[model samples]
Every structure is written in structure tokens, then in C-alpha cells.
Target chain A: MSEAGEFDFIAQHLAPLSQGYEGAFGLTDDAAILADVPGLVITTDTMIQGVHFRKLEPWDLVARKALRVNLSDLAAMGADPHAVLLSITWPQAVRPAQMQRFVDGLKTDLEAFGIPLIGGDTTRGGELLVVTVTALGQCEHPLLRSGGEAGQDLYVSGTIGDAVLGLEVDTLAGLTGVHKAIVEDRHLLPTPRLKLGRELCGLASAALDVSDGLVADAGHLARASGVKAGIELDSIPLSSAAETWVRIQRDPIATLVKLITSGDDYELLFSAGPEKREEILAAAKRAGTHIARIGSLIEGKGVEVRTTSGELVRIDQAGFTHF
Target chain B: MSEAGEFDFIAQHLAPLSQGYEGAFGLTDDAAILADVPGLVITTDTMIQGVHFRKLEPWDLVARKALRVNLSDLAAMGADPHAVLLSITWPQAVRPAQMQRFVDGLKTDLEAFGIPLIGGDTTRGGELLVVTVTALGQCEHPLLRSGGEAGQDLYVSGTIGDAVLGLEVDTLAGLTGVHKAIVEDRHLLPTPRLKLGRELCGLASAALDVSDGLVADAGHLARASGVKAGIELDSIPLSSAAETWVRIQRDPIATLVKLITSGDDYELLFSAGPEKREEILAAAKRAGTHIARIGSLIEGKGVEVRTTSGELVRIDQAGFTHF
Candidate 1:
């Protein structure tokens, strides 16, 4: 028969998925009503096709990335995600199968994180597929980037630069086998350290998700706190595959610089007092996530990187810029 | 000499506007935090260039419409807007000046509505400019479309069909002066009847904002409440301009049918019990908005319309569909 109508499409594929969420009103009402909570943390992120991801990327991964990026923001704030509102602007070329796969991926991640897709809006746009997810989280005292003090130790959860390397591996022809697979997975899916983030609520003085380069994000934290950040080059964490690739490459320093400057890591970059180091480590151990002491907040302003030998490094470009 | 960077852009233009809102954290943190309210209402709406509005439209009106539509949803639920999260996917062609104008327009509405722009995402997309606004509102007891009963009186606030006619005026040639301006204003900028909506919370048994055609939206209310709505075609409220146009037109019945089928009214369509009619009228009077008793909900399914002479009318197209 004729193609399914808009209401029919939503009722068949989307409505059933939202049944358990009492506030969603079965997606029948104009807006969803949420009960009172202690505090609500809200973050929104928009991802565009071709600009944010390759057109050849699977729908599942695309959907997961869109949701995960917002979750990463919530994690940065040390909040537990409660629900999500998704807005999708589908490209004219998108088919029903593609839409189904995208929703399936979203549902998969929502279930994994225990966050319900409460409500959203779907519309038709131009050639690009634009997805925006507004994640609502709860935290009594949400972490702020401005909370860092001058003497705080800057730390990051999980290894960085794998996503950048993954992008390179996908674009380049030389990489192959397990190395490529690992980095590609990192690029396709980012693990938002929600548990560790919630655990770090009272521990981390300042926090943020690393979407831009490490130094750039550190600069943000430093500027917000009116302090300077000093990052030691040798202390920067790297994956085994990335280290192996760095060892094989001719210019190791340039590779390291690229790793530090490339964005899209999605790791929690935070700062805590030096006295809390043991507690931080204990929390990380409990969460089963690695923690790295990469830098320190100083008395001045901006971000400074120190070399392995003790020389201060001057960087030209710090991170990715959309405009 | 070089254009301001993304962070600089946000700091200079966006940060200052968000200073008054304590939860916004001056737009510096990863997410915005909101304190507890009695009840929370969330709504999201997406508008795309060309499809939703002409590219040539002024940035001020475009931004206003984008925000107002989401506010309309909150109003439909009898919620008072508290905060908004905006996600905009800007096209590459957008310049710094254009961006400033868009933000200025958004700021105007935020100030006017007394709602803060708490958080959002800005990214580059393809040719289309896609804007999504997620409004967070508060209400002790929100209105629902499913609350209407069989004997309830169906009433509509303000006027209908002006927006649709406005769209026609923009695309077609003929209309000029006040008529053109009135319809165009209705189409371009919608005033979210927030006061009236909040006032109707205890009075209106069922309520919704008319984004799609009246008959179709009435059908939605009908299906949600498991009752049939009977609308008197003659009772459909029309602006004086629209009424004048109807009187002058050769085929008035077709014009009226088209008006009823056209969408984007943004007026509140509600149902109330006959006993609460006086209270509803008083509420409308207090809110300073016109209310029209168009029909009643019957013990059946779907929506039916009767002509001035008592002849029943059938509509082929109920409402606008995206798919």
C-alpha cells in the first residue's frame, strides 16, 4: 500500500518504546511533564552528517555518538542522566530502514544508560542529517569548570587521542587489523564515564568533557577558574595502539602533538586538590576506569605545556574550531 | 585582524546574556543546572530553512518564531516557561553579523518571556539553517488532551486561519496593505498565549496548541479522549481581515474549508464541561483573550463539522503531515 504516514510511523516505531516513561504521556500530549527532582542538569549537542561523521558510517553508530556526546557532558558535570529529549532533522534521502536502524541504536544506548527517551521533534531538512539531544540529568551539586583552584591537580579519565587516530585510520590506507579496529571503535563509540563521574561529584573541584583538544579544554577550565594550567607532555595518556603507532612513526614528537591537539576524545577532564589523589584513585579503581595526572593549575592564566626535558612548549593551534 | 574564534564568539555574545540566570553558570560550564520546581514541562520544536520559513526572512522574526513555537507547546500544557535550550545548526554561509542578529533576536524573546537561555549547542550544517528550541516549563497540574469527556464543549481561543492565509499571501500575488500585513504577521510571528494557557489549567478539561489544521488537531484531541468532536463551520473564529476576504471571495465555502485545513495557528484549542462554561469565560476574560464555542464532543470517534444551515461537511485532508 502507500507509505506509512507520520503519525503511523511514530505510533508503530517510536511510541511503544516510550510507554514505560510515565511523564512522556505516550507521546500523545504537546509536552511531557516531569516530576520535581533535587536538581536538573541540562546539556544539548548537535551533530551534522558529513561535518561530524562520514556518510558511510552506520546508522547505529551515528545515533549512539549523538546520544553519547550529550551524556559525556552530563558526566563532566558529575550528574546521573535521567531522561533525554531528541530532535532529528532527517535528510531528504533518508529511508525508513535507515530511520529504524538509527532509533534502534538510540534505544540500545538509552537502555544501557538507564535513561528514557521522553520526548522530541522530528523534521525534514536539506541534505544533512542533523541530530540534537538534550539530556536531563540529576545531581545535588553539579561540578563546574570554574571550581578549580590554583593548586589543584588536573586529571583526565581514560586514554585520549584514540578517536583522532581512529579517524585517521579510517581515512588512511596503511593501517590494518586489530590496531585499526580498536581505534575505529573508539571513534565510532565513546564510553561516557557516568559511574566514575558520579563518584567524582564531591572529589573533582572542576570538570569538563574533552570534545576539543586536551590543551584547549584545559585552557577553558583554567580561564573559567582564573588560573593557569601546566600540562607535562610525558604525562599525557595514550592507548597501547596509539603508543605503538607513535613508536613506529618517524616524527614521534609531532605525532604526540597531534594526539594532544586533535579533538573528540569524550573523556572526563577534571581537576582535584592534591590531597584528594588517593581518594580519586580509589574512586577510579572502584569504577574500573583509568585515571591520569596530566597537568596542574598554576597561579597565572591560559594553558602551558612542559616538555619531557623541562622546556616549556609553545603551541600555535590548540583544538578543533567549528567556524 | 582575524575573525573571533568560537569560544570568543560565545563569550562575547552569549555569556553576558545568561548572567542573570544563576543555573546557567554564565554559559561557561558543560551543562546548565536547574533547581527543583513543582512540576516540569518539556517541549521541543525544529524549524528548517526553506521548509519552515524563507531564507530571505529577517533573522529577528525567524528566531522569534523558533522560540515562540516551543513556548506555544508549553502554553498548551498550561505551564509557565522557565528556561530554554537552543540548538542551532548554522549553514556555512552564516557570518558573524548574521549570527549576532540571530542571537539578538533570541535574547529579545528570552527577556520578554522572562526565560533564560540556559544551555545549547552550536554547530555547522549543510545549506539549511536548522534551529531547535527545547523549552522547560513549570506547572502544578498541567493540562492534557486526554481529559476531555463526551459532553464537553469544544472552544478555541483567538482567531484561526490567519496564519495559513498569511502563508498564501506570501507565496501568491493579489493581497496588499493591512490584510497582507496582518496575515503575514500571523504567519511570521506567533504570540504564545502563556497567560491564557495558565489561566485555563483548572478550567479547560482538554487543551492543545493548533500547529496543524484545526480539524486534524481536533481529531487528535478526539482520539486521545475517545470521543467525537462536532465543530460548527460558521463558528470557526476568523480575523476581520480573513472575514473580509471571505465576504469578497466567489467561492467562500472552499475558502473556509481551506482555512480550516491550513495549519500554524498556534491558538489554544480547548474543551470544557458545560457546567464550567462561566468559569472558562471568566478565565478567558481575565487572560484578555477571545474565546469561541465552536462545537461539542460526542460519544463517538473522529471529528465532524456542520455548515451554518445544518448540513454535515466532509474534509478530504485532515492536517499537514511531514512524511
Candidate 2:
């Protein structure tokens, strides 16, 4: 087929998928018009096939991950996702069936999340499949990382370190059966805590999604708010599977440090006053998500970690970074 | 350098560039918050290294092209450029100096267009460099391709075919000096008709940008409006350099057809009633851009083109398409 056939493919498979959104203009216009938006929250993320996920991974899960990561950004801001724009570059060897499954995955997520595919661009000629999603959401009271006050207590939702540990299990084959499957699922698909984020809107002082490790992301919150975050290492929440793996490790302290520093945990890490601790816990419980108080913001700079034995721990690497 | 060092690079280079936009939150928050926007115009475009441009093309022009293409979409919607979010995937071999030059180019265009860098993501992977820019604009009254009526006249701004001819010149190495430079520049940097598009908001009933050739894009406008667009081949404007090349060609008719069907003009194409011709001409004059009446919308399906001798012309290939 000629390159122009790409338009035909989009018209056939993708245009109908966007029919639910009137602003999409049947996916025929150069731009999409969004009207009656109360407040717009914008976030974008790019995922490369080999770098972000294994090449053998299912196309549907790949699509879901691409969309959900951006959705996670919205959830961090206490926003309700409304629309998404995707820019994808497919490798020349990609088959039509793979493309169909990918679109199907996007359609499922758009329906499930109550967000519509509004607009996007597709191009050919990349060594790897590259998917970039720009998600737009609405928030009445959008949370900012800079909103954390010095006296506010830091809280995190969901267990940490499962994703990285899942990566290790998948790569090294060190774990067996259910434990491996559980952690691998955590690595493949992250739950975006959307309900918990929305519930924290007026409750939490500041919030962000923990994609780049708890300690590293906390440093961002600290720098933005001009306050230091003092985290208790022992207080960090861990999944039962991760705890089992750590207990078996020779140096449990080292394993715990690695867990706190490993990235790709798409949970909400936020701050609120100590007075509102009960309210925050109630909100998390109502949203059916776990909440743990792991730290407090203090008058200073950067992030500090304190071990259970009253010793300060030094971290060699805080989180994942792209260079 | 460790992956955590990427944060240092972003802080040193990108964060300072985004300081002008208050909503960006110094690029520290998980998402950017856009408040008090009238109506949002969202458009995204992805450019692959080899497919879109030569691999060795200057980094600055590549950056400009990536940003301008999406800005052209906003112009087609008659929206004022507001902000941009970029998602870039660099090859593993890319040097920091190269990255810096690329960002400098983005900085130049962002300042020139008064559009701030709101937020984005950068990753390391892909054999070829890929850049995707999502431009967000604001428009109280936006133009739509579906707004055209059957009796409206079709008009196009600037000259067509220069960009494709420029590509031919670059690849074939047949042209040299000034002519080569002009066509190459046309391909490298598309002048988005922002002022003219804004001026045409209420004057033109329907509008689009001619990135996929004059005919194919006009077909898009036709399909969206449920009307037939009959274009006069002789009326299509050509740059002086393009005219010179055509005059020297063995088969000028074929050349004209190729020129009209060639994509990447990046000029505004719109439809308006014949009664508003004077107003359209005046708007173009005020914007200091040339406007020409190419044809009219008729009662039918698809697009039709007539030669200067009043003979119907058949197009073999309508425009450039990505497979």
C-alpha cells in the first residue's frame, strides 16, 4: 500500500473510535476544539518500546500503559481526565493486526476512563514503536507541588517498590509462580489512583504521582515548596510480595533502601497538615486505596531519610532518569 | 553520567526556558495547569528523522519545523498560539551538545512566536530521532472544515508546491545557489499564517491548512462540509522560482499537476461566499499576505479540478501520506 493509505487506515479504524466526542470533528480537521472546559490540566508522556517496555509485550497493554501514565499525571493534580491526543510513530514492520489491537486497547481505556480520544497524529519510520499521549483534564482545585507547607505531613497511597521488583523478577527469574505474576502485573500495569486523587483535592495541601521513586519525587516537592521532606525509611509501605523478597535477601536494609529509591510506582505522594490526618485517611479509605504517612515537611532544603535505629542513610542513586 | 543526572540537565537548560509561563510551575509539577482559557485548540504533529527531513539537517531548523507544523494546525483553526508541550525521543548516540543546540532552536522559536514551553517528556531510545509537538491555542471563534456551504468560493493563501520542489532539489542536487536555497528554506521552515488565520475567523465559513497538498486537503474540507470543491488548476499560485522551473520542464502540464498535488505548502485554504470576496481580500491585505480565489464549492461529492483550457484534469496521486 502507498503511504497515503495511512489516512485511509485512520479513517477506517480510528475515526469511528473517536465518534463519541463531538469536538473531534470526525477526526477530519487539522485541530480539535474543546469548549466549556472549566480548567485545563495538560500533561504529556512518551514511551519507547524497548526503553519503556519489553518488545514482546502485548500491544494492548502497551497502549494501556501509554494512556494510563498520562492519566496518572492528571490524577496527581486532582483532575478528572476528559480528553487525550496521541502521537504515534510505528516501525515499518508493524502488522495491521498489531495496529488494530493497539487501537482497540486505546478504545477500551477511553471508554473505561470516561475520556475521549479527541485528536492526534500518526507517522511512519522509527526503529521502535513510539507512543506519546497528551491528556487534558479538568480540575476545580488543581494541586501543585509547590503547595506543601513546612509543617505539613507527607502521605503516600499504595505500596512502593513492587514495580521495580517486578522488573527484577521478570528479568532475573528469581521469584516463582504467584509472587512473580503479582509483581509482573505491577510492572506492566499501574493503577492510577484517580479516585484517591480526586478525593484529596480539597484535603491535601500538595500532591504528585510517584513515577520517579519516592525519595527523588519528594525532592521535587521539597524544592518546589522550598521546604525539606524528612522521610522515615521504616514507615514506607511495601506489598506482601515485596516484603517476602526483602526478607529473603541477605541485607534487608539495603533491600529496603533499593525499594524506596526504585522508580515506576504510579501512586500518589502528597502532603497535608497533621490536623487533617484523619480526614486524609478517611478520604483514602472511601476511595478504597491504602494511605500511609511516611514523612513530614520541615524548614530546610532537599529530602532527608532517617533509618529505624536513629541513623541517617545516604542514597547513591535516588531514581530513574532519562539521558 | 547516571540517569538521575538528566534532571540536572533539564534544570540547567529547559527549566530556565520555561520561566516566562506562570502556569508551567517552573516545570516541577506533574502537570501544567491552564486557567482562564476561553476555548482550547489542541493539535499534535510527529516528525521522524529520515521520513520528514534529512538526517543531517541543522538541529535548529528541525526544531522549528516540528513546532511550526503543529502551529500551522492552530492557524488553520483560526486560533492564537498560546503554549506548547513537546515529547522528544533521541537516539542513544546523541551528544549533550547536540541536545543543547536543539533546545536552543526551540527557545528561539518559542520566544519568536510568544508561545511558552509549558511541559513535555524526553526519553532515550529509537534509532531515529523523533519529535512531537502539541500546540495549545485559544480562540473565541474557531473555524471548522464543516462550516463551508455549497455556494462558497474557495481561496488559498501564498504559493503551493515550493516545499515539495525544494525537497526534490535537495535530494537530486540538480538545482544550486539561490533557487536551491529558497526551495530548501520553504521545506525547512513553513510560515504559519497566524495573523491571516485569525483575521479569517468570521470572514471565511470553513478553513484548513494545506499540508497534505492543495487538492487532498481541499477534499478533506469537501468531505467535512458535505460539498464538492471544484478547483481551477490555472488559478493555483506558484512561487517565482517554481514558475521558472516549470517553464523549463519538458511537460509543463504534468509539472503543474505534480505541483498542485505535492504536499507541505503550510498555507491556509478556506471557503467563503462570493459576496464576501472583497472582505476576504481586505483581510489578506491587512495581514500582508497574498490571497487568491482558486475555485468554488459545488453540489457534489469529492473534489474536481479544471485546466486553464476548461478541460477536467485527473489526478494520479492526491498528496503525501504516511503509511
Candidate 3:
């Protein structure tokens, strides 16, 4: 079939995603008009193929990951997505079929996240897809990385590095059965912890999503909050299958250490007061999620990783640096 | 020398752009926290090298035009720019020297326009630079293309087709004169009609910026407003040099027709009633700009060109359509 026309395709798929968005204008004008709501939290993230993701991945997974990553940033700030602007760049050319499938996959994710792709730009460029999604959200006193107190407890939502482990599994040979598929799926589609983020907004002292590995992102949170963080290595949550997979790979401790340092976890790392700890844990359990009391804020700088042997491991490079 | 570091580069160049902007959460946080303000307007536009501009163009010119295009859209709604988010896809891997120059140019325009670069995403991709700018503005009642009424006088701000002629002269040889540099500058650095836009916001019934040529964009205004538009060729404010150049090369009338359909003339094409014509003229004078009565909206849908001899010439295509 001929490629879906831009206007028609947008009208059919994009309109539904924006339905019920309280705005004088949503998407049907020269520009999308949003009512000036209080506390507008806006964030933008761009992912380029080969740099952020490999083209070897499926189209659906790519679309899902791109949106999820941006959503993850909003979640870190405890914001609900209001609208999104998608600036899409296709390699000099894309097959009409491929483009259609890509747009369809994107449409599905936008609908799922309740964010309308309101406005953006499209252009031809070199090989690789570059998609920059700018999200407009609303929050009352957005959770900032700088809000953590020195004595506050640090907690993380969900397992730490299953996605990284999954990536390794996909590349290595001799891995078989359900474990491999599960690992690959984890690497492909990471669920942004939106519910826990919303619940922790008022309760948590400070927060940020783990994107550039646990160690690196932890440092970021600490630096932003101007407080050092101490994490007990044992407190880093690992999936049962992931743990077994790491153990089978050789030195389990080393493997786990490497995994924790690998980026793309998309989990929320937050701080909470001693009084709010029980309430936070209860909320996580009710939501069918796990909270790991990984660390606590300290009156210093950087991260201190305490090992099982009670020795602190100092990691200088915390996460991925794009530049 | 090592390339300029990302953080320091942003701090030095982009920090000043946010000076007078309201609620601009600098580059430190996860997102920009915009304070709740009524009557906010948003618009986005993207410029790609080889598609929107040539790589050989000066960095300052590219930065200025990239910003001007988006500003033109906001101006169409009679809004003043508050903040801008730039999503940049570098064709080659980013180098610090080139990046500094690019950012410096962007900073200059942002400061001149009183809009700050609040946030952006940078990614590596393709062989062409893609800069997508999303401008946020605020106005009481945004002027939309759908607000025109039948029998409204269709007018344009400043001159039309100067940029198109400039582009032609800059690319093709044999057109040697002061016109070459002046036209090239016009094509490179367009002054978006921000003042007229603000003044016309409440007065003009319908408005849109002329990006994709006058005829095509005027047609868009007509279609959006559900009215027919008729343009008088003689009334189009083509510069004397442009008229002379066209008269020597081809039929000036046909050239003018093509100019009306050529893209990249960042003028404002708006429709207002005769009652507001005097007020619009006065506003243009106050802004030290010219207003041209190019067309009129009627009770039909299609656009027609009125020749100097009174014969009507219908164009097959209105503007360039990039899919």
C-alpha cells in the first residue's frame, strides 16, 4: 500500500491519544494550544539510532523505548504527561512500509501513555532515526534531585540492572529457553515507574530516574542534591533469573557489579524521611513493586559502595557520558 | 585543543538567553519548571542542512534563520516568545569548536528576541544537521488561521518574495550586484514580524506566517478560515531590483506568480475586516514596517490570481509539500 499520508495518519492515530486532554486547543490548529495550567513540567529527550539504540532492534521496540525513556524523565520529576512534541529525522530515506510501521508503533505508545503527539518536525538526513520527544507535564512542586537531605534514606523502585543483563544475554551464546527471551524483552521494553513516581511525589524528599547505570545516576542525584550517598552492595536488587544468570557467567559479584554500572535501567531512585519509610514501602507493595533500601544520603560528595567484606569500593566513572 | 565540554558550553552561551524569561529552570534540573501563566502559545519548526539550508552557510546565519522561522509561527498567533527548546541532530560527531560557534550564534538570536533556550536534546546522527526549535509565547487571544470572515481584506507584512529571489541569486551565477548580497542576507536572516503579530493579535480576524510562499500560505489561511481568496499580482510588494531581475530573465508576471508559490518568505499573511485596515496600517507604521493589501477573502474556497489585465490565473499547486 502507498504510505499513509501525514494528515490522515495523524488524524486517525494521534487524535485518540489526545482525547480528554483539557485544553482549549489540542492538535487541530496551526499550533497546539494548551491552557496555562499551574506548575508545567517540561522535559525533552532525543534518541538517535546507533547512539541510543541499534537499528538491529525491531521497530516496535524502538518506538516503545524512545517514548518510555522520555516518560521515565517525567516520572523522575513526579509529573503526569500532558502533551508531546515529536521531532523525527529519518535517514535520507525510509521505505513507506517501514515508516508506516514506525508511526503505528509510536501511535500505540503515545496512546498507552496518554500523551498526544501534538507538534514536531520531520526531515531527511543520514542513516539512522533521530527522534526527539518533548513532553509537557503538570506537577505541584516537582521532585528535584536537589531536595534530598543528608540523613534521608535512599530507595529504588524495581530491580536494578535486568535490562543490562538482558542485553548481555542477547549478545552472548549458549543462553537458551525462557530466560533468554525474558532478558531480551527486559532490554527492549522497560516500564517507566509512573505510578510509584506519582505516589512518592509528596512523600519522597528527592528523586531521579536511573538511566546512566545505578552508580553514575546515583552520583548525579547526590551532586544535584549536594549530598553524598552510601549504597550497600547487597541492597542492589537483582531478579531471581538475573542473579542465576550472573552466577552462571562466572564471578557473580563481579558480574553483578558490572551490571549495576551498566545504564538503561529506567527505575526510580528516591529519598524519603525515616517517618515516611513504612508508608513508601507499603505503597510499593500495594502497587506490586519492590523497593530496595540501597543507600542513605550523607554530608559529603560522590558515592560510596560498601561491599560484603565491609570495604568501600570507589568507582570514579559513574555512568555514560555522551560528550 | 579539546572540544568545549557540554556543560560548560551550555553555561557560557545559553545561560544569558533565559535572563528575562519567566520560570526558566536552568540546565541543572530534569526539566524546565514553567510557572503557571495564562494565555500561553506554543509552536515548533525544524531546519535541516541540505533540506532547509546549505552546510556552507555561516553558522550565525543558520542559527538566526532557524530561530526566526519558529518565531514567525508564534508571531502569526500574535504572541511574544518566552522560551525556546532546541533539538539538534548533528550529522557528524559533535566537535567542541563547531558546537561553540553554533551555540554562540543561537545565543545571539535568543538574546535579541528575548527568548531563552530553556532546554534541548542533542544526538548524533546522519550527514546533515537538523535543528528543530520549539518556541513558547503568550498572548491574550491567539490569532488563528480559522478566524477570518468572508469579505476580509487579506494583507501581508513587509515585502514578499525577496527571500525567494535572494535564494535564487545566491545559488545561480550572472546576477551580480548589491542585490546579490542584500537578497542573500534576506534569505539567510529573516526578521520575523513579531511587532506586527503582537499588534494584530486582537485586531486581525485570521493570521499565519508566510513560510511556504505567499500564494500557498495565503491559500492555507483561506482554507482554514473556510473562505475563498483572490490575489492581485500588481499589488504584491516585489522590490524594484527583484522586478528588474525578473523582467530581464523571464515574464515578470510569471516570475511574480512563481515567487508567490515559492517557499521561505517569512512574512505574515493575515485577513482582517475593512474596519481594522486603518488600524493595521497605523500599527505597521508604528512598527516601522510596510503593509501590503495583497488579497481579499470571499465566500468560496479556492484561490485565484488577478492579473494586471484583470484576467484570473489559477495555480495548480500552492506550495512545496515535503513528506
lDDT of each: 0.86, 0.87, 0.76
Better of 1 and 3 by TM-score: 1
TM-score of chain A of each: 0.96, 0.96, 0.91
Q: Each prediction's DockQ? A: 0.64, 0.71, 0.48
TM-score of 1: 0.96
Clash pairs, candidate 1, are none
What is candidate 2's CA lDDT for residue A208?
94
By DockQ, the candidates rank as 2, 1, 3
Please say which candidate is ahead in TM-score: 2 or 3: 2
Candidate 3 error regions (>4 Å): A1-5, A12-16, A20-28, A90-92, A122-128, A166-169, A251-254, A314-316, B1-4, B20-23, B90-92, B123-128
Q: Order the numbered candidates by TM-score, best leading.
A: 1, 2, 3
- Which of the CAPRI classes, incorrect, acceptable, medium or high, describes model 2? medium
Give all TM-scores, in the order shown.
Answer: 0.96, 0.96, 0.92
Better of 2 and 3 by lDDT: 2
For candidate 2 chain B, the 10 contiguous residues with the lowest summed lDDT are B168-177
**lDDT per residue, candidate 3, B1-323, as tens digits?**
11125455556666666674444555666677775778777777667677678767766678788899888888888887778887776655656667667877887887787777777666555456767787788888888888888888999887777788777774545466877777777888888888988888778999988876788777778877889988898898876666666777656667777778887778888989988878989888877778899879999986888977999876666764444
Candidate 1 lDDT, B1-323, residue by residue in tens:
11137777777877776747888887888999986777889988878888678877888788999999999999999999988888887787787778888888988988888888888877774676778889999998899999999999999999989998888785534455888899989999998989999999988999999988798889989988999999999999999878877777788888888888788899999999999989999999999999999999999999899998989887777866444
